[model samples]
Target: MRMEQLASRLTLKRAGNLVCSVCWRRYKRSSIVHQWSRYWITTRAQSPSSRPSSSLKGPAALGTQPTTPPITKKQFPSQLELRAVQRLDVLLEDCQEFLQKEVVPTEDTILDALKTCRKLSEYFRSVKDQPALSTIKPGGEAGNLLFLDADPADTQTASSRTLTPIAVGRMASSIAEEAMDKIAETIKRIAVDKNVYITSKVLQEVVDILCLLNRPESLAYIFILYSSKPVPKPNQRPLKYTKANPDRITAAIPLKVAERALDAAIKVQNLPLCLDIIEHTVSTKAYKRAKTLRGAFLPAVAVAMTPGAAYIVASRLAEMQEAMSTSMMTVIGTAGIITYIGTTSTLGFIAVATANDQMQRVTWQAGIHLRERLVREDERAFTDKVACAWGFADPRRRGEEEGPDWEALKELCGIRGMVLDNVELMEGME
Candidate 1:
């Protein structure tokens, strides 16, 4: 009879928990809850009390403090731990749109987003009783601050923004590495899941982050992320015309100045700015058709030019100028374009020749020194066939410092191009 009662109660409880039926059945003597309680009490009567003592209440639960719920893979979110991921998410979406519908970018603009990432790390570390910081990853500087001010995806004009597709990819990589678990999970899903469509902006941000990582996998991921199309960062600073420079107000800049700025920007390994300076030098001269280049780069030129090399190169340049002029006159017979080439031909040739020679020697010397510098710093065991540019350029190639000489080479390349234009030009002539 006891077993029968227990079985009936169990059946009633199961039925009650499953659903409340509206069937026309007779009501039992006891309710499901009452039966459950009475049975539970009787079943464990000889055991211990499972219910609380009723003393410790509410927040102050009895028996070993109610421990905070542990973070689970499903429960703990990245946003909670990585605030930077939140900021980066907004930035990445915006940048990816820009890259796809508009401009692909470098990591510059997204750096602010990464700054938040550093904050996330700091916050996370702090929670773990540790301090956090932002460390400059070597060669990761190209897209570092590139994305500070990005333009809308459909915005016209390069001046609208500097965010490039390449940069966007890099930022994504950074988020993947540093963002909290929550944000990272989302980003990874975007990067990998096939069904879900990852936007161009998101992929681009991923590229920016991965490029900074300078890992082959990151690079590969970038390609995979953008497997649909090959994209390049559009021209951002197109055709800007600023006053030549201070100290000299003239119709044009001297050749020396043009070479200097271009060289210095290269030598200091400031290629991010170097290409622009080089373009400016060439364009301003081409359009102005002035006897000299823009003067803005004068001070830098004066500082970098070597007098001894200048003289020899200048002499050679003068001979070439005379020969070209003679040939031009012989063909055109002192007419048309040749007539204009003669306006300040004599003086122009002399100055250009000297500047060219000086530029040549400086480049050679710079190369030798730059190689030494990179070698020392990274301890690169560069073979005769190798010429590594940045620290992360060769992900697989390793090197030991070879002293200050190796480091010097890198510095030279940083501020100066490895090959001189004059030398290349001369080779072309020969």
Candidate 2:
């Protein structure tokens, strides 16, 4: 009985070892085949020298019977490998369809489609002859993918003949006006709900589109909408006013956008739009607001020096003064009436006494500043012309009386006897 049990145990152990040895050999063979397959694919893909010959010949052409047949696309070694290739192909087709059919192909949708293509390409990278993986290119057929293509001739004609700068501006304004309703609704929602916030990127994109369209007026409107603080209600407690933090708001216009709008407004001579931008920038406490305002305002006021413009400037300045007065009254109202009278009377006296004097000084200073800059620019231009003429003129005429006389040139230019700084002339005008 003991001898029979030993023989049975030895037989079981031997059987287990044989099974393990066979499994190990199978695993080793699979690993070697995988390595060779990967190396062959890589070499063929990278170098034309290693590629299989296109010509077909009999086995006797090499003077020996064939040992192995060449692999083909339809004859993948394993079912799993074949399935993976098929899956990658299907995924690529799906992505192509999605890109073609997307109604509003935004940046995100395009990126998602590219990501799908990339994954599929990586999976089938070992398939050296696969055209689908190799042919795929980023932004291939972009116009078709985004559905943004129009007839080139029609687009050119429409843009050149029908879409003038003014028409473009009007179209941009209309688009911005349509967006304003949505933006206002968002703002209201954010005001009501503390957790709600606007996406900065979306707002920036809107601003960018408007600027690209050259719609300064619309951009100024956006700036004004965000910069103006809400008026406090009489029945409700006042909300604490913190310094404008862009991160906290549902929608905050950037100072650079305001600057760009201001520049565009100046370029198109849109005075009202320029003024609106200045007002918003000042209200928002944008950095360097005063400097930007002065730069924009001086050029505009200097260019449009008509009586109507003077009246507009005067009216705007008066409005500013009135706003200041109202703010003072509000502060005084917070205290008792007795203190209000003393403070109000004192402030009123000071304001009345100095307002006219300050206005005159400001007007004089602005005129002088503009005149100085103009004179310097004119001098530089004159110097440059003189240098160029001297450098390029005939050397033989260096000492001859060929050039125009300075006095004669001045006379012809209508400044022969003009005195720039005559005290008697200034006093007579006054």
Candidate 3:
């Protein structure tokens, strides 16, 4: 009886060791315990009749575990993200209020709203593909902590919040499209009434939007306002106007903005407007060192219009031949002489006009100013026509003192050594 008991105990101990070794190997390799291995070993060790099988092929033979889907981490908004959302909400509210108000908003108010609208548009574009989360989940400790400090008011605010970047952007865009006339009027008022310095960054943002809206006329208007020289004090107050003591005129906008305005004018193909822009550029003090006024402005016009001038000369010569029975050689010689004189006078005029006042005085005394009188009285009509068509305002005709605007002569728009380039718009020559 003792020997049988000993043999049974040995067999049970051996079976227990085999099951433990297999489980221990599995745990070492896979880092997970087989659930049934502990129970099987204990039952066999106690009973000894149901011996563990050595033919066991490991944890796989115990049947597969009931497969479970993974528990994915839930995303929650960080403090920074929450703050950004709050800021965006406030901006949208302000913008909506501005849009709904019947009265036109102030310049600062309008500017603020515009900036908000732009921010919303940009934000929507950036996050268009991203999933939006409205609220935190109630299951997790992180989610509970996220809303722990929130009062009833915050909860109500969160619940009532209807603003989204896309919604705000669309609202602003649609309102702008619907009431463009009012927008134009407001912008015109801002340009004329407000003297406060608007940064080029803001101006550029507005300009880009205007371009997108296809409001070229408004763009042209803005260009004219910014680029053109401000009306002299005397012009503004006609009672104070005097030819000899006229107030100095300076442009309100800086050089770069003025250039943008010129491009805007040219885009609209408004010749008179182009001439006005050129006049402003010529008068700008920054272009003094360059040959903008003397070499580029008038000279470019003279060159471009030379063909038309030649045609006029040829027509006159033919008329003279028919009336006086003159030879073709005489007519051709007359035309050549006229062309030579005209070209030489134009060059000489440019040189003298750009010279010091003393030199201009000498040239004036040398009867250079008398050249216009020697031309036929009939040609005066043609000259006036050309001047009118080109929108050329003779600086000499203006009796104002030719002095720079001392106050505005400093570096503008934080730019140093800036100069307006010579861009000759020959749209009217056709």
Question: Lowest summed lDDT over 10 consecutive residues: which window, candidate 2?
Answer: 11-20
Best by TM-score: 3
True-structure lDDT of candidate 2: 0.35
Worst 10 residues of 1 by lDDT: 69-78
lDDT of each: 0.33, 0.35, 0.37
Clashing pairs in model 3, backbone N/Cα/C closer than 3 A: none
User: Over the stretch 165-205, how does candidate 2's per-residue lDDT look in tens digits?
Assistant: 34333332332333333333322322222221223443354
Candidate 3: tens digits of C-alpha lDDT, residues 143-197: 2433455433333321233334343333323322333433334444444433323
Please give the lDDT score at residue 352 for candidate 3. 52
- The TM-score of predicted model 2 comes to 0.23
Superposed by TM-score, candidate 2 places the C-alpha of residue 95 at a distance from the truth, in angstroms, of 25
Top candidate (lDDT)? 3
Residue-pair clashes per candidate: 80, 0, 0
Score every model by TM-score: 0.23, 0.23, 0.25
